[model samples]
Target: MTVQTSFESRSPATGEFLARHRVDSSVAVDAAVRRARVAADWWAGLGFTDRRRRLLRWKHVLVRELDGIAELMHQETGKPVDDARLELVLAVDHLDWAAKHAGQVLGLRRVPSGLLGFNLAASVRYLPFGVVGVIGPWNYPVFTPMGSIGYALAAGNAVVFKPSEFATGVGVRLVETFAEAVHEQPALQAVTGFGDTGAALCRSAVDKIGFTGSTATGKRVMAACAQSLTPVLIEAGGKDAAIVAADADLGAAAEAIAFGAMGNAGQTCVGIERAYVVDAVFDRFIERVAAIADRIRVGAEPQAQLGPITMPAQVSVIRRHIEDAIARGGRAVVGGPESVRPPFVHPVVLVDVPEDSEAITEETFGPVLVVNRVRTLDEAVDRANSSRYGLGSAVFAGRRTATALAHRLHAGMTSVNGVQSFATVPSLPFGGTRESGFGRIHGADGLREFARPQAIARQRFRSPANLLSFARTARDMRVPMLLTRSLHKRG
Candidate 1:
């Protein structure tokens, strides 16, 4: 008899074994994709109206069991209950929006055929890719992956989700809830395992893959998908920054920066990893941030404001970055390297960090913030844009200054006066540029991302000025040139 293989998922808070999940082999992943393909046809036939209604039902199911799912998220990810609840709330909101807005966003729309093709009618519609494979991260297990899964399903595709091994239970629960919503189709499923499982999903016969994880892992996922000539969308790592202008609201800025940098132990892809403050308010900003950080509790307690570093290995990375920053003329105003206490890392605020140091350059997915002072807002913008990863950023300034500074950053999403709140707004597209990865996963753009656009042009009536037919004469082409010159030449 062949022995069954599996892996253990342990709690990051106590290092206790939580559950055992099968390690999905290449064969298993291929089977899941094949099942999805079979279900995709039935799902697509449901049409926009029916699919929209069914998806709203799915959203209702998600809302009904939100508490239970949040608990699972807390157990698997070691996040506080409140934090898990907040993540679930945002995820449910996205699902509702995706379902409600799918028809208007992806339905066929008439397009102008132009004067040159006046005899033709043109329109375009988005078609689903049949099947989508999603590789989710553990940090924001439900919210992050659902950004792809919810929109893809709304766009008429079956999804096979592969959750991070550390958070397999949460992924399974989400799939089960979806299954309950649309049981006749069974179009949604989960495959749980480690790196090999994710790689297998990428290589499977899915039409596209939506991946959320580290930049290194995203490259690997993209490479695997490339083997099959499959299209992929990646939401990778980030070293996002928060820029505080001299004219910014100090109290509000300090609160936003502290929460943005320390929430979920700073494991968010769009978390405020660095801060650039104008020289005039640098000292005052640090003082306010430190005061705020000192009051935030970090532990596994129910009331704790911050939680453990879900990935065990990240503690060391956080320690290394903090030490490197301190060694290179940086001062720790709040916590320090010693703050990395096993699973729970308290907040750490480092001031005057060098630009070239690892703490400023690398993605330390822990509750650590590095603040630097700049002579001018332009210098701060220049320094923020210097990073290789440009996922998300925050700008706190006067209305005009904030808008101007936001335009200068290279990030995909910039929250003016807030920190990453754009993520909660379902109408805005979210993703990154540069090393942070490509493609979007929210709003109308996200619905279209899981689909392919096909354009149709039909001849409404037979015209003497036919241009696309072999019967067209050279005189027909001359007419267009003459019209172009008359309409556009130096006019």
Candidate 2:
């Protein structure tokens, strides 16, 4: 049976439904992909410069209408308008960078041919994957999904986007703008529905799928994509950690930990869910962070520093983590289960939590963070890498030592002394390995993700091995084969 987008999307701050629509069926998904194929051909045929021009025009729309878009995002998400703009600002910057750099990074390049193929010329080029399916999350809806959509378009692939059911209005607006930028075809289209719509995309004949959601859902998506041997990139959930060393900048650490933990009401996949503070600064650091958390308020009002929890199901997850930690000998240094006030979830600063507690080891996916004291940097690193997730991390230490510690963490990207800044830097690749998901989604790696590598070789002449063809060449084979073995062997 097919599902409908009948569920109401409510504002987290006010608990009011925003908008709703009907879900797309397998039939609709197939039609979308078919349309995308034709669009892909047109999008691909355009020179990189022309494609970039179109993208820039689309970006201009976003810039000119920034205030309107930001307000819509804020009303729909319950996040402050300022915070909503943060998502757009970083997103526009990435769009700009991708447009300017796609040709230089993704154009054809020469491949070296060994001496064995001296008479042949070889080169490699990136070919579009035809159509790509992007299943995006509701948090930072525009910025997150655009990471896949924009890059796929720049790489010459048409995108069929299935945004989170909760953000169908935003998704529709995005597609409307995309159509405006390219009047000839539907380069980007939306299929608004629930998991069934996403599953339909997974089962369809699309060339690749890019998904961003929880780890459990990611596993299911991977299994579904495996049925078609379709490549997938899953920017799944994370239990990202921040390490506060004795030599760290305490003020900066406090700011990073607080925002990394509480931003988007802690709805982000790469948000900081755990913190390891050096025993030396544990007391003072905790006090400073707690003060910051206390000043924060969660409501629909524009003055609040933070907002209410966006996903209703996430409320239960946050409660479970806090209760589990408290039952497992952990204490809530600041806020606890009582902090979750339905529509508006206040920031919870958990301290004295066990390193193995669910609060520390699991993804609360809320405005909650667990702070544990460690004696050494070794202990901090060990605790940070203990979880099954390894998406993103942060290290607050000396420049040299921070880089060293970041390398040791089992994550894809690390911010040396900042929070969420790595995701803003389009120059670096994004995404994770292991349970966090495989593959990348930003930078040159992102452009290549929606494309397949094609290698071409041109032969100038026949090889010496042709001498052994119909003639009496037993002796010739012996000489050539012997020479091949001798040349291959290390003296």
Candidate 3:
């Protein structure tokens, strides 16, 4: 295949051109990784304190240019400015949390010496993995990738980011802003291009790759990384569900489900794609959700609650899912297939969608929701967990029931009485399980994801019963055998 040399980004809301970016070749990607390796050594040598200071400086720089950065995000992704700003705010908050907590999370700590090695002292510390390659998605160009970039940098690893072609401008601007803060070295850099550019990064010598995109693209990334035996952290597609129990606050559940499913034109990875409401309250819940979803305006205007679909190809996918649901005896309570306009899809609330339909089974990543009625709360939980993609989920019920239902959901993260709330808390680990992809990108687990743990052992003094010594005779081992038997024989 002929690799495209360069690509131009245009506003998704309009056909207007935004900016053009050079597609980095394999050689360019290698050079960038080589630079990152050198920078990683220096960055790691800075220790936790210095790295924290530098990362905080970068956060400050991001805050200073918040408006400009958000504007660029809006132009490229066609998301509302306020939503763009909120994305930045979450990214910045994760950065601050990662910077401030890296030491405590990855710092050296003493470990207990087992009974078999009573004379030995042991300690463990998580050390950086030199370099990390990040492939970001356009839907959340800033916040989603920052979940990896910020935590990796905090853990003392140099990062070479490969952002989505649709959001090239925002990616480049992010790297440029980082240079402004950490001028001493290229610890954080971005390579812009299409799929081939990202593939090049995956095949490069980076210690690990952090990828966030569709499940299909994530599989491609894993395949490329497999050639080099490099590790990967994937945050892929999610057909997340929301369970509304009979006791749930119908108004609150409706509002959250509407916003969760339709926000950002329904481009969110962890957004609600399916909803299961108990049969007793299904009618009332559907009525409220349809009402709210109908009032949500979609446009490029500042006052609009939702913006245009950032990716042009997704418009057809959205239309297909809606049509499939309707064909399978589902009713469009709010908007029908006709609501799908190029670069814009109105909120679609589907009721009685077949369990096997595309809208319920696949990741219908548009402003569409499949709401189904369940005979009981247990049935709701079972239906919710039936999807192959279990990234995130929500449970709307009373405190006791919500907690119970949340725990029953087979997902990496779950929010009780709220939607997408797990993502806003910087201290919580993010990512998904099963086909939604593995590995975390926030909190302590996020820091450790970019680093390797090193265990150290030192002999405080020699023991007379040295079990590891070859010079010991059979009689010398008798005491240890008896002690071991006495200690563990009961268990």
Candidate 4:
């Protein structure tokens, strides 16, 4: 296939041309990696304190230009300015946490040499992987990619980011701001294009690749990286669910679930896609959720609560899911198939949907919710855990019961009595298992994800036995054998 040399970025809401970006070819991608490798050496040479200082300076720049960056994000992604600001706030917070904690998390640490190797001193430290190629998603142009970009930079690796074609402008802006903050080198750079460009990046010489997108696309990335046996950290699609137990606070649960499903036009990967409510309170809970869904406003107006679907292709998927649910005998309590308008889908609440239906099984990636009635909390947990994607989940119940229920769900992160709250905590690791993709992008795990653990051993003194030398005798073996028996023998 002939790769396009350039692409246009247009507003999802109005189709207004935003900017044109040059597509980086495989050769251009390789050049970027080479530059990043050079920058990585300089970045890694700076000790933890100096690196921290530079990162903090970049953070402050982001803070000062928050409004401008959020505006750009709004134009590029069709999200409300306020929502864009929230994304920036969370991204900045993660950046701060990663920068401030990288040393404590990845710094050198001593380990006991053990009895047999007492004369040797051993230590381990996480070293930067040189360069990392990041493939960001358009759904969250800033926040999602920053989760990887920020932590990778903190861990001392230079980054070459490939922002989704739909959000290329935002990505370019980010790289420009980083240059403004750290003018000495191109430690953070962006290469823009479509799937070919991302594939080019995956096949590059970067030590690692961090990707966030659909599971199908993630698989493609893995395949490309496999050519070079390069490592990858994938944050893929999610069909997250929320479980509402009998003892839950119905109003709070309803509000959170509604927002979780409808927010971002339901473009969020970890957003609530399914809700399983116990039979005892199923009717009341559905009514409450329907009420909240009815109040949600989705449009380009300033008063609107949700913005247009950033990617136009997703609109059909949302409509199809709603149509499939209704065709499968599901009832739409809030908005039905007619509620789906190109570029904007009003909140939809589907009930009585069959568990095997596409609406319940696949990721709709729109402002739609499927609520099902379960006979018991155990059944609710079982049904929720049956999905292939296990990215995030929520449990709404009494404190003690919620904690127990949260632990039972098969997901990477669970928010008890809340929705998508685990991502707000900077110290908590974020990522999912199974089809949702592997590896983490936040907290200590995120720092280590972009680095390599290097072990060091030094000979403090020579052992009298000289067990490793050719001069060692049978008597030396006998002494070690006797010592092992005395130290390790037990009842």
Clashes of each: 0, 1, 0, 0
Writing each residue's lDDT as its tens digit, candidate 4 over 138-238 gives: 98898899999999999999999999988888899889889988999899999988888899999889999999999999999999989999999999999
Off by over 4 Å in 4: 1-3, 486-491
Q: Tell me the tens digit of each residue's lDDT in model 3 across 335-360.
A: 89989988789898999989999999
As for lDDT, the candidate ahead, 2 or 4, is: 4
Candidate with top TM-score is 3
Model 4 clash tally, residue pairs: 0
What is the number of residue pairs that collide in model 2?
A: 1
Model-by-model lDDT, in order? 0.92, 0.87, 0.93, 0.93
Give the per-residue lDDT digits (tens) of candidate 1, residues 1-491. 98457988888887788889998898999999899999999999898888988888988998899899888888889898888989989998999899889989999999999988798899999999999999999999999999999999999999999999889999999998988889897689998788988988888899999999999999999888888899999999999999999999999999999999999889999999999999999999999999999999887778888878898888899999999999999999998988989988999999989999999899999889999999999899999999999999999999999999999999999999999899999999999999999999999999999999999999899766767789889887888889999999984
The digit string of per-residue lDDT tens for model 2 on 107-161 reads 8888887766666788888888999999998888899998899889888888999
Model 3 TM-score is 0.99
Error of 2 at 318 (Å): 0.7
Ranking by TM-score: 3, 1, 4, 2
Candidate 2 TM-score, true structure as reference? 0.95
RMSD (Cα, Å) for all candidates, in order, is 1.4, 2.2, 1.0, 1.5
